[model samples]
Target: MTAQDPNRVFKSGFVTIAGAPNAGKSTLLNRIVGQKVSIISSKPQTTRTRILGVCHRPGAQVVFYDTPGIFAAGDRFNAKIVGTALSAVAEADLLLAVVDAARPDPAAEELLAEKIAGRRLPVVIALNKVDLIAEKGALLAMIERWSDRRGCQAVVPVSALDGTQVEELVAALIAALPEGPPYFPEEALTDATERFIAAELIREKIFRLTGEEVPYASAVTVEAFKVSADGRKVSIAATIHLERDSQKGIVIGKGGAMLKRIGSEARREIEQMTGASVFLKLFVRVQKNWRKDAKAIERFGY
Candidate 1:
């Protein structure tokens, strides 16, 4: 075997994205990875688990961990989700704190500032959703506010939805990471399995189409996944767990029309993601206050 050249430099490390709910953290992860590694929706707390998105650059490999939004944990489940986000902060080589520039939340900003305080890791504040801010002064003020609050190493304004200044944000993050070999293969985009992604796609549709608390009380689990003989098609059977029977009825809707709509939208997305025909079967069941039950929450992989 030949000896490796000492002059060849590579930067690779984990970058955790943490922010308040609906702050565009997941959107940023998807945009930077050039794929939909994390589910995105307007509803808060849509992401309940840690999602890893790997970005392979010319001289760097960044494994981005998209965490649940940091917020006040009013219940056991909420606390678990917040704990997941905080744990991600502790494992990062660099921290990208995304903040909504258009509608800045002081409490959310303060929560992140406190978590990152006294940490040795480099922190970069991503002032996200800049496209929504029509006033240049407001955007500049937001940048300054976060800079003063977190004392981050860099503040890069970006709009993850429209790919505005996203490359610049990536450059900033890569610059902060230390040089090392790639942590993941170049072909790998995320650590999540196909089953998990399919389930998330279904949940995302529910969050998008449903109103009120039904979306928040819902969870999807892929119970069965099968591939056709030729591998040209995929079949998935998932169960959507609801906290109440009424919610189940809401998800099913009249004549099962709502469930069909959710299934059709999710199937289309899954097909696009897997590059194969997808037959998605969705079933709704009441779990009886599953969110409040620790056992049920663990069973659902929250």
Candidate 2:
């Protein structure tokens, strides 16, 4: 007699999580995938494009794409942001219209209603940050409003920080997913490469160090990345290109102390991630008008 296995093959699909700036979209993604694929900050509009975070379960692979927050189509940059978010919704097998449960906005609801007007895909409303709501009545009211407007497949209350209802959310997402082969290896956590993560780490450090225009106009690119085969040590050289010399001075700070602190913090994070000694070398370069330079944008993987 032949032995029969009880476990059946599971399905896979894509889930796109998108919302307005500072809505805790990235925080939820990092929690769901259990890694930092996207950078987080108190600053609004930190994410500029789609960042993929993969989750591997026993019989399924869920590739979650975290897109930039949805704002009104403004300038070229803002248009790019809106386009990326909407594109993810259009292409995804499912979408999670993540809303900040603590601070529900009517504008965000209107945006969601407009998107779901003619779409056939199932959208699971992730009412995130539910822990912040003190009154249960307010939470229910928010849920009822969204359900009435868009008729969500599921309106799940969750705290992405404390991880309440996240597993159930994952299960709901997987159940809605279409059948497919694994999109990525089980061991992979993100679609971003080491170099991209390194640059992001540096950018994140810059975000923490300086405020205002410097963070807005700056971009980091890894000029060189080298690692030993045994994984004992790593060498990375990156350039922080700015639009003007004044921004560069602010980044470097008085006596270069600010830059040094930034480097130390980034290197420490890199070391923890790679479990290797790190030799981080940073340079401040002037790339005037890089954000508007098409060639520079392409080179930076934007």
Best by TM-score: 1
- Runs of candidate 1 with Cα error greater than 4 angstroms are 1-8, 149-151
Q: Can you write out model 2's per-residue Cα lDDT over 29-58, one digit (the tens) per residue? A: 999999888888778777777999999876
True lDDT of residue 19, candidate 2? 83
Model 1 CA lDDT for position 287? 86
Q: In candidate 1, what residue range of length 10 has the lowest lDDT sum?
A: 1-10
Per-residue lDDT of candidate 1, residues 47-157 (tens digit): 999999999888778999999999988999999999999999999989999998889888778887888887767899999998998887878777777677544778999
**TM-score, prediction 1:** 0.96
Question: Local error of candidate 1 at 142, Å?
Answer: 2.3
